[model samples]
Target: MKYLVMVQGTQLDYEAMRGKASPHSPAWSEQDVQAMYAHMEAINNDLSETGELVDAQGLAEPAKIRTVTLGDDGKAVITDGPYSETKELMAGYWVLECESLERVTEIADRVTRCPQPEGAPNHPVAIRPIQDGAGDLC
Candidate 1:
């Protein structure tokens, strides 16, 4: 079966507090983000070689985000990106063809183990089984 794995956004105040001199852990920096990308690329390359990677890509900045939504009036609302009203935003996602949920869980485990910037928050990969034939109607 094919499954989708994506990062879940964290809370806004939790995301906003990170800084260089954070009384605690610092927020993600450009270098931190770059390193994260490198880690993702490495994982993707390995997955591709193992024939586990169905497809995956890094997400763009939230400010450049866009999406379609429905309003109370039932009107189609073409609005800005990401629905998360918090600081933590989806970084990217992956669609993997796996033998079982356990297999995908292992993949998520490895990804969550990735070294992240300080105060990067928890790594929560949401997994969902993709329904087939639904696209046929599309």
Candidate 2:
């Protein structure tokens, strides 16, 4: 089965990673950012070697987001964001083809342990199984 493993962060978190310190998060040093990239690379490499990785990507900053809602006239109403700077938004995700939920859970655990600045928030990692088709009833 395929699973989507996601990690979330606030706008403050993104700023911190870019070395901008705010009351909510500390600035990350160049080394701190490098370490995080290396850790994630290692995990991706391992998954690739094991033939379990489908796709992976990191999202752009929250400031560039566009929210679309249905207007009363049934047209798309667009809103620009840096919406609720403290609200958690998806930071990155990995699509993995794994033998079981336990395997993906183990990978998510490793993601949670990725190195970060000393005062960084411990964000939770989420995993959801992908439904291939209607045959996946349940």
Candidate 3:
């Protein structure tokens, strides 16, 4: 089965990125940020070597995102982000072709273990199966 593993970071998580600092440290440090990326790369590498990874990518900050909806007159309405009501912002995603949900969960668990600022909770990793050929994905 093909699965999508989505990473969601909370508002606090995004705020912590303003300056580099280990969540456990008293001061910001670039090393902490580098370590996080390194950890992510390692996970991606492992998946690639195992031939389970289809695609993976991180998203730009939410401030740069835009939301579109239908207006009262049927015209498109646009809003800029920092969508406050959402508990978490989607940070990144990974697509994988795996044999079972168990395998997908294992991948998600590994993602949750990546390093981040102190007191920042693990970003929720949502794993879902991709439906086969029911309609055009595009």
* Tens digit of per-residue lDDT, candidate 2, span 1-138: 999999998888889999999888889999999999999999999999999999999999888888898999999988888555448888999999999999999999999999999888989999999999998985
Q: Which stretches of candidate 2 lie over 4 Å from their true place?
A: 82-86
Q: How would you encode candidate 1's per-residue C-alpha lDDT over 1-138 as one tens digit per residue?
A: 899999755433234333333433457666765776688888899889989899997665566677888889999999775676545666679999989999999988888877676554575788888887778456
Count of clashes in candidate 2: 0
lDDT of each: 0.73, 0.93, 0.81
TM-score of 1: 0.71
Using all chains and alpha carbons, the TM-scores for the candidates as numbered come to 0.71, 0.94, 0.85
Task: Show the colliding residue pairs in model 3.
Answer: 20-29, 23-117, 23-118
- Tell me the number of clashing residue pairs for each predicted model: 2, 0, 3
Ranking by TM-score: 2, 3, 1
Candidate closer to the true structure by lDDT (higher is better), 1 or 2: 2
